[model samples]
Target: MLRAAAATHLRRHIITQRRRIATPESIRAVAVDPSGSLTPRAVDLATLRKTTGAPLRDLLNLDIGERTRRQRRACVLPRDKAVLLQLGGLTAVINADEALFFDNGGEERPRAALRRIGASVEFAFQHYKAPAFELAVLEAVLAEVSSSFQRRRDLYEPVVQKQLREASCEFDGFGVDGLHRLSAFDGALMSFEAETRQALQVLDELLASDEDMLGLLLSERRAGTSVDPERHGVVELLLEAYHRRLSAVAGDVAELRGKVQAATELGRVTIDLNRNNIIKFNLYLSMSAVGLAATTSIAGIFGMNLVSGIEEAPLAFGAVTAGSGLVGAAVVAGFHAAMRSQKSIEQRARHAADDREALTSLLANMATVENVFDDACRDLTRPAIAARLEAATGKKPSEREVEILFDIFDASHNDKISLREARSALHRGDAHPLIT
Candidate 1:
C-alpha cells in the first residue's frame, strides 16, 4: 500500500510540474516556391530543422527566448546549399530553388514588408521566368529594408523639424512647458537614432557578406568552375544598387541625428545661461536685502525708549535719517566692491592656470622639437612648423596663416624657422606664441 501511494504522489507531482512549464510559441513561416506560390504555415523546431536542413546547434539559435544569440547575422551553409539571414525581425533561409521566411511578429508586422517581396517575385516569375529567383528575392528584401528606413524617416522627419522650429522660436521662454516639450523631443530622437543605427549595422553586415560571397564566386570561376556570368552580373548589380540606396538612407538618418544633437546641446546651453542669470539676480536681491536690514536696524535703535540728549535737538531727526541712508548706501557699495574684487581674483586665477598649462605644453613641444632636430639651430620648413604647432596645440593653422607666422618667427627672412628662433619668439610677450 505504501509503494502504491508513493507512486501516485510522484505521478501527481510530475503532472503539476508539467502544467507549470510554459510551451514555446510556434514560429509562423512562409514557404516561397520556385513556381512563385506563397504558402503560409506554422513551423515547430523539428519541422524547421527538416525544412532548412540545419544542424541542431544552428536550430538552437532560433529559440526566441535566447535573445542574446539572435543578433543579426548571415550564416551561409554551403553544405546544405542554403543561406540563413536574420535581418531585424525577419529571418530567412534561402536555398537554391526556394526560400522560407520566418516572421518574428512584433508591433511592426513582417507581412507588410514581405508583401513587396511577394509581389516582386510574382512579377519576376510571370515575365523573367525566374532566371535567378533567389537573388531577386534577396534584392527585394534589401529594397524593403531600405524602404522601411525611408518610411520611418518620413514619419518623424517633419515632426522633428516642427519641434526644432518651435524650440528655436520659444528658446527664450524656456518655461515648464518648453522644457517638457524639449525633453519629449530629445527622448523621441534618441529612440529613433538608436533604432536607425541598429538597422544600419545589420545592413552593413549584409553588404559585407554579399561582397565576400561574390568574391568567392569570382575566385571559383577563375579556378575553372562553371559559374554563370549572367547570375554573377545580376547579383553584383542588385547588391550595388541596393547598397547605394541603403547608404543614402543611412546618411539621412545620420544627418537627422546630428541636427537633433546640435539642437539638444543648444537648448542645454540656453538653459544654463538662464539659470546663471537667475542666480545673479538672486545674489543682487540678497545684497539689497542686506542693505535694507541695515537701515531697518538703525530705525529700530532710535525707536527704543532709551534716548540720548540729541532727541531734543531740532536737526536730530534729519541727521538721523541722513545717517541711516548713508550707512545703507555704504553697506551696498561695500558688497559691490567685494563682489568685484572676488570676480577679479577668480579671473586672474583662471588666467594664471591657463598660462601655466600653455607654458607646460610649450616646454613639452620644445623638448620634442629638440629631440627630432638633434640640433637647436636646425631650421624647420613651413609645413614642419605647422605640423609641430598642430601637434602641440591641436590647431591646424592655414597655409597663409602659417606662412605669415613663420615669417614672424624666422626673423632672418630665410623661409625657414630655426628651433632656437621659434623658442625665442615664443618667449617674447609682443610676438604671437604658436603654443597658445
Candidate 2:
C-alpha cells in the first residue's frame, strides 16, 4: 500500500511539473521600457496599454481580431504621443521611450516582416540606447526597406547575369536552341518585374509620405540651422539603393528585348534564305523533268511494233538504239539552249520597250546626257513591263505566256496605241475567252 501510494504521488508530481513548463501561446504581448529592457511575462491588450501608457482605443484601428483582413498600416497619433504600426500580424505602440508589441504568433503570420521589424527595433535599442519614437520608426522602416531591396537584388542579380551571359554566348550561333532559351528567359524576366514592382511601390509610397514628418522630428530634436542630416542620409540612401536596383532591372529588360528582336529577325532571315534555296532547287528539277520527258518520248517511239529495215543487220540494232538515245539527248540540249536564248531576247525586248517611251519623252529636255538617261530609262521600264504582263494575264506569266502576251500587244503598239491601252486590250481578250 505504501509503495503504490508513493507511485501515485510521483505521477502527480510529474504531471504538475509538465504543466509548469510554459509553452509559448499563439497570441502574445510584450512591453519594453525606456532603459532598453524587455518586460517579463507576456501581457494582454489591457495590460499592454496600462504598462506603455498608450490608449487601448488605438488597437481598433489595427483590425487585429480578424485574421484574414489584416493589412500594413502606420499612423502617428501626435496627441497621444504614440505611433501605431501594424504590418501583417504584428502590431506595436511605439512611444517616446517605451514600446508595447502585440503579435499574433500563429503559423500563418507574416513571419518575415515581423522578424525584420523586431531586428530593426533591437538594433536601434542596442546602438542608440535612447532613440526617440521617430528615430525608432525610421530605424525599423529603413531596415525593412534596405534589407528587402538588398535581398531582391541578391536573388535576381545572379539570374539576370546568367541571362545576359547566355544571350551573349548564343548571339553568334543563335538557332532553334537559342530561341528556346531566350523565350524562357523572357518569361522569367516578366515574372521578376511583376513581383519586384509591388514591393518597390510600397516602399516608395512610405518614403514619400513620411519624409516631411521625419525631417520635422529630427529638426526639432537637433535645433540646428542645417537640415536634418540623419533623415536625408538614411532616406536618400534607401532611395538610391532602390533606384539603382530598378535601373539595373530596367536596363536588363531592354537588353533582353533587343536580343529577342535580333533573334526573331535572324530566324526570319534564315527562313527566307531557306525558301529561296528551295525555289532554286525546284527550278532545277523542272528543267531536269523537261529533259527526261524528251528521252522518254524517244524510247516510247522505238518500243512500238513497227520495224525499220536495219533490224536485219546484226550491228544495225545496236547502232539504231545508240543513235536514238544520242538524238534524244541532243534534242533536250537544243531545246534548253533555245529556251535560254528566247528568255534573254524577251528580257532585252522588255527593257527596249521601256526605254523607247522614256527616251522619247526625255529627248526634248536632255540633249547632252541622253546616253546616261537611256540606261536609267531601261531599268525603270523592266519592272513596269513585268507588272503590266502579270495584270493582263491575271496570273504569274511564264516565259511562254509572257511571249504570247507580247505578240498580242504588238498589234496594238503598231496601231499607234499607248502601253496602257494595249494592256487594256489584252485584259479584255483574256477576260472574254473563245466559246470553243
Candidate 3:
C-alpha cells in the first residue's frame, strides 16, 4: 500500500508539471500555401512557440532574437525556418510560408510587406495568396528597405541643395536646421547600411551552410522520398540574385555619403569665411580706438596744472592745438597704411597663379600679424602649417627655411615678391635655395 501511494503521488506531480503553460499572449498564425492561399488563425503564444520551436522569450523581447540588435536591419533563423525583418516602420516575422505579422493594435497591414511577399500562387488544388517561393519573403524585406531609402534620399537631396544655395546668404545659411537635417539623414543612411550588410551576411551564411540541405534530406528521409535538385537550384539562384541586388544598393549608399560629405565641406568653408570677415571688422574697430586714445592722451597732458610761457604767447594755443591735431592724424595715417598694405598682400596672394607663391604670401601676413610663425618657429610640432608648406613645395621645409619664408612672405605686395631680397635673406639665414 505504501509503494502504491508513493507511485500515485509521483505520477500526479509529473502530470501537473507537464500541464504548466508559459505566459498567455494572443497571436495570429497565418498558414501560407505555395498555391498562394493564406489561412490566418488565432493561437496562444505557447502553442505558437511549440509549433515553430522559437523561444518564447525571443518573441516577447524582440532584441533577444536579433544577431545585431542595436544595428541589425534583418535577421534570419534558417535552423527554425524563421526570419525577422524591419521594413520602413514595420517589423515582420516569417516562419517558412507561415507568418506572424505583429499588428501593434493597428488596423492596416504593412502594405510594403504584403505587396512584395503576398503574391497569388496557383497550385494544382487551389489558388492562395502567399509568398511564391520561400526566398520571396526575404526579397520583400529588401524591397521595402530600398524603397524607404530612395524616398528619404529624394526628400533629403532637395534640402541639401537648398542649404547649399542659401550658404551665401549669411542670415539664411545652414546654421542649425541644416546640421540637424544632415544628422538625421546620416543616421538613416547608417541604419540602412547596417541592415543591408546584415542581410548580405545572412544570405552568405545561408549559401555556405549545409543546414538547408540537411533539413531537406532529413524531411525526405522521414517521408521515404528523394531530394529534388531542380527545387534546390531555384533557391540557390534566388539567393545569388538577392546578393547582387544588395551589392548595388550598397554602391548607391556610398555615392549618397560622398554627396553629403561634399555638402558639409562647402557649408564649413562658408562659415569660416564669415568668421574671418567678422575678425577683420573687429581689427578695424580696435585700430580706430587706438588712434582716438592717442589723441586723448596728448590733450590730457596739455591740460595739466603746470603752465608754460607758451600759454602767454598769442599763437601758443593755436600752435599746441595744431601740433596735437597733426600727431593724431599721423597715428591714424600710419595705421591705415599698415592695414591697406596687409589687405593688398592678401588680395594678391589669393589671385596668384602659382600656389607656392600664394601660400608663401599668406604665411607672411599671418606670421607678422597673428604671430603664428613665431610660435611655429619655437615649436616644430605644428603639423598644420607644416602640411600647408609641404603641399605647396612638394618637400618638407626646414625650420630655418620656414622662418625665412615668413619674413619674405610678409614683405610681398600686389602679387610681386622681391626674389633678390628673398634669395639674400635665405643666403644669410638658412642657405636654402629659393624656389624662384
Candidate 4:
C-alpha cells in the first residue's frame, strides 16, 4: 500500500511539471480553422505533435533550437498531409483543414506572415468548399518574406546613399570617425547581403518543392484524365508571381552590394592617395633639412678658432656664403626634380592600369551586341562608351572628358569608338587615356 501511494504521488508531480513546462510564456501558437476563425493557444512541442498527429521525427524537425542559429527551410510531407516552414524564428505548419503558427519569441504575436495567411484563408472560403489552401499559405509566406526584405532594403539604401554622399564630399578629409563609420556600414551591408541571399534561397527551394509536389500529384492521376486547370494554374501563377518578387529583392541586394563595394574602394583609394602625399611631403622636408645642414656645417667650420687660411682671405666670407647657398639650392632642385619624375611615373602607371580596365569593360559590353558593327568591329557611340567607362571606373567623367576619350579611341575619325581601336590604343600605351 505504501509503494503504490508513492507511485501515484510521483505521477501527479510529473504531470504538474509538464504543465509548467508548457506554459504560455514558453511557446505561443495560433490555429486557423476552416471557417477562417483564429484560435490562439499555448502548446509545447509534445502537445503540438499530439494535436497534429505528426510523427516524432517530424516534430523534432520543428524544434527551432537557438533562435539566432535557426536556418530557413521548407518541408512538405504529402503522406502526413503537412507543410512545415521555418523562417528564422517563425515557424508555420499547415495541415489539410487547419494552419498552425508557432512563434518562438522575437517576432510580434500574429506576425505579418500569419495575418497574410489568415486573410488568404478567409478569401478562399468564399469561392470553394476546399481550396488548395496550402498554396495560399505558401504564397502568403513568400509575400511576407519578400516584404520584410524590401523593408530592410529601404532602410539600408537611404543610409548607404547618405554615407556615400558624405564620403564623396569629404573623401580627402576622412578621419578616424569616418573610417569607423565606413567599417560599420560595410559590416552591416555584408550581414544584410547574407540574410537576403538566404531568404532568396529559401524562397527558391519552397517554390521548387511545391512544383515537384504538383508534378507528383499529376503523375498519380488516372491515365488520360484532364487536369484541373484552376488547381494547377493557380499554383503556377502564384509561384511565378512570388518568384519575380523575390528575384527583384535579390536584384536590389545585388545593387546594394555594388554600391557598398564602390564606397569601400573609394575609401581605400582616398586613404592610399593621402598616405602617398604625406610620404612625398616628408621626403621633401627631409631633403630640405639635409641641404640646410650642409650650409650650416660650412658656416660652423669658418667660425672655429683654428680656421683655414681661406676664411682670412679678402672677400672670402662673401664667396663662401655664395658657394654654400648655391650648393644648397642645387641640392634642393635636384631632389625636387627626382621626386617629381617619380611622381609622374607613378601617375602614368596608374592611368595605364585604369585605361586597360576600362578598355576590357568596353569590349565585354560590346560583345553582348549581336549584329551592331562597323567594318568587322563592334562599335559603341560616345554616350554609350562614356556610361560603360563610368561603370568600370566607378567615377563619372565630364562631357568634355568623354569627348576627348572618344576622339582618342575613334582612330578611323568616326563619331563612334570601336572595341578594336580602344583595345589597340590601351595596349600600345602611346595614346593619352582619360584619367577617371
For model 4 the TM-score comes to: 0.56
**Model 4 bad stretches (over 4 Å):** 1-26, 51-58, 65-79, 106-113, 127-130, 172-176, 206-212, 215-234, 306-436
Which is the better candidate, 3 or 4, if ranked by lDDT? 4
lDDT tens string, model 1, 120-233?
A: 677777878535556656766677666555555554455456557766776757632233444544555555455556655654554556444453232244346666534445
- Residue 418 local lDDT, model 2: 38
Cα lDDT tens digits, model 2, 399-427, are: 43234323433454443323343424323
Q: Give the TM-score of candidate 1.
A: 0.56
The TM-score values for the models, in the order shown, are 0.56, 0.37, 0.51, 0.56
- What shift in Å separates residue 94 of candidate 3 from its native position after superposition? 4.2
**Candidate numbers sorted by TM-score from highest down:** 4, 1, 3, 2
lDDT of 3: 0.49
Error of 3 at 434 (Å): 74
Candidate 2 RMSD to the correct structure: 31.4
As for lDDT, the candidate ahead, 2 or 3, is 3
Better of 1 and 4 by lDDT: 4
lDDT per model, in order? 0.57, 0.48, 0.49, 0.58
Model 4 Cα lDDT, one tens digit per residue, 1-436: 9999999999986675555446523466788765666778665666656655567556555653213333344444433346666653357777656677775533333333455557667777767665556655665566666665564555456546666677677775653124434555566566656766666565565456655545323222323565554455556566678668767867876787687677778888888888999999999999999999999999888768665688669999899899999999999999999999999978876764554454333322221111122112246887775665554334565565555455455789879776666545434232322211
Clashes of 1: 0
Considering only N, C-alpha and C atoms within 3 Å, which residue pairs clash in candidate 2?
A: none
